[model samples]
Target: MENCKQEFEEVDVVFSKTKHLTKEECTKLQLQDSRLVSEFQASKLEIDAKKNWDLFYKRNETRFFKDRRWTTREFKELVNGGKSCSGKVLMEIGCGVGNLIFPLLEEEPNIFVHACDLSPRAIEFVKNHPSFSSDKINAFVCDITTDEITRQLELSCVDVVTLIFVLSAIHPQKFAICLENIYKLLKPGGIVLFRDYGLYDMAQLRFKAGHKISENFYMRQDGTRSYYFSIEFLRDLFTGAGFNIICNDYVHRRTINKKENLDVPRIFVQGKFQKPS
Candidate 1:
């Protein structure tokens, strides 16, 4: 009777690796074997970043990226009590085609939005959008890493600055300068809602070795740059810029493709930092 009970209690289990790639396979699949770009070429790309972005907009027009439908759900502060709280001022840095801004305006029509992008063509698209209103949105082309940004918007007048997937496109060295510029424009207690690619995300892993511009930064064939962020680095960056970190965390998920037999892990870092009141 004891032996029979023991046999009945035994269980069989199966275990599988979360990711199937071996070290060599991963290296072969991800790393590019082509020669790295020369310093001169890299410099040219950096200087021509704006031109490249203009070309990008001209190529893809308004159909490249999907509208961010999750902003209201993720950031309730941007909308109070189901509708846009009146008189709130928002600046969407790197506002590409008014994706985020337009949706927010649809929900909260009373808020004023200041939208800027490095690409003039992108700003043009925003201005031409059917929903755009001159009174509701102030759209312009300004590179935040330069002094030109001040000419487009006044300092200390903005209530919230949204940096959605924008900072990663700028050089890491200029990150602090961009943040400082935003800080000068934010009102006391104003918040910056941030989201960007996180370190070791599938996008970064997909970069060829030669495309690597710097540590965790890569240049795509299209001439744009992308940088992956770590939670610690991002927290330090905002805090060092004089903002208090209210929240910082990684959003991770695994995407599976049955046809390709691929399981890709995507990581994004989302944070909210506020200027001291």
Candidate 2:
């Protein structure tokens, strides 16, 4: 058991190696997704984005996403790169129901977190969790694309920012302003840890006709939107927001469930970007 645990730490198992999609497969999927969502429906989805997310949590609560136990393993900066994590201030944008926040706090109890989500229902879940404490976490509702986070927390106060699976929910047109808001919250030397769905992932390929909002962007049945990212596009995005890229790449993994006869390949873009010191 000890040996297995050691191997888990040594290997980059957070993102398992998986086979890439072939050109023929990509072409077939694209061909099947030729029909696009009507402009009226797309506009409605964008306008009601927050409302839709609130409804999502109201229905599923914290059951939708599993606890993100792999965050520390995937991002060393979260643990101060083997140094003490004491006194570090971190912020998690789009913190849904405290899935990442609670596990992260359990892992490193000394660090404080400021967690925000677009859905007020989600914030309530974070606040009501059994492990929640006012001293350790400040959970709030925020629309990062437009709201001034500095109003709730001071400017340049964050040491690190975690944007896991969050940016993809936003409209592509607002991504610049969203990143700019996050940039304002980080200290000069602070880093942003980003992870999100990548182009041609199984989820993206699964979208059928009338789901596509635009290239690499789609609206789910529940009305929340998602935008797929490529490594080059992600690099340009962070760089354009005045963040210097420390590292950025695509992470591939395979999800398997023998009981259900399910096997799916997942692609994600993960990166670390720093504000110029």
Candidate 3:
């Protein structure tokens, strides 16, 4: 058993090798063309964000994203010693196809989940899933930017809110409003767990010249928008909303495809912010 454990550790070490880039290198890699926005296209994308997301779900169904299995390891408070959560409440803000929530439910059956998404189709998929229990999971449609979240959930009741790759989808101008709504939904001591694209990530650098919508934001060919964030910007946004940062850092990983001869570095900014008691 000890030898097997050692072998696994060595494998992990080999795969975890990452290459860090300097600021100059990253700047040079970003879309070098002028960041210009076409008013017509910008307006269309903003208005059709929901429509685009709905189409995305209709086309991909529930299979596009892999289940996130790292939550339990990253946020230990979600489960207690491989057992149940003892009934902590969690809200997943872009709960697509029950990925994070379902895995978490499997781990801690006693915990309750409030899952919301802007796409009704995504919520429908979650509700129809075989493991979905109406008693334990409340699946609803909510637009954090415009909807009154309190109407859907009791104010100051959530214990933890997970925002995994959700914020990057919204327009940067509305980020503050979205964060403010999330702030009101959490209890005085509630925590917000965040993980999203970091500035100059490979995905960001790959955008073509015409796709740049604004500084660090772009629209993909699919009509969905993505915004890359810097740690300082995220800290300011969360702190301005009255949350105290518990932990904030960039998570860097390198993926190597030997067959394709490709080595890609991915950077993601993750944070845990607590609403002060």
**Tens-place lDDT digits, model 1, residues 1-277:** 1234332221211211123446965675455545566688778888999999999999999999989977876777788657547898999999989899998888888899999999999999999999999999999999999978877778999999999999999989999999999999999999999988877677877776678777777888899999999888998999999999988887765555445666656777888999999
**Weakest 10 consecutive residues, lDDT, candidate 3?**
8-17
Could you tell me how far off, in angstroms, the CA of residue 121 lies in candidate 3 after the best superposition?
Answer: 0.7
Model 3: per-residue lDDT, tens digit, 1-277? 0243322211111112223667866675564455556979999999999899999999999989999987787777678557657768899999988999999888788889999999999999999999999999999988989746878888898999999999999999999999899999999999999989887778887776688888888889899999998888998999999999998777775665555666667777888999999
Q: Candidate 1, residue 25: CA error in Å?
A: 8.4
Overlapping backbone residue pairs in candidate 1 total 2
Spell out the clash pairs found in candidate 3.
none
Per-model TM-score, in order, reads 0.86, 0.90, 0.89
Best by TM-score: 2
Cα lDDT for residue 41, model 2?
A: 88
Better of 2 and 3 by lDDT: 2
Q: Tens digits of per-residue lDDT for model 2 on 132-197?
A: 999999999999989568678888999999999999999999999988988899999999999998
* Model 2 poorest 10 in a row by lDDT: 4-13
By TM-score rank, best first, the candidates go 2, 3, 1
Question: Which sections of candidate 1 miss by over 4 Å?
Answer: 1-35, 81-84, 256-263
Model 2, CA-based lDDT: 0.87
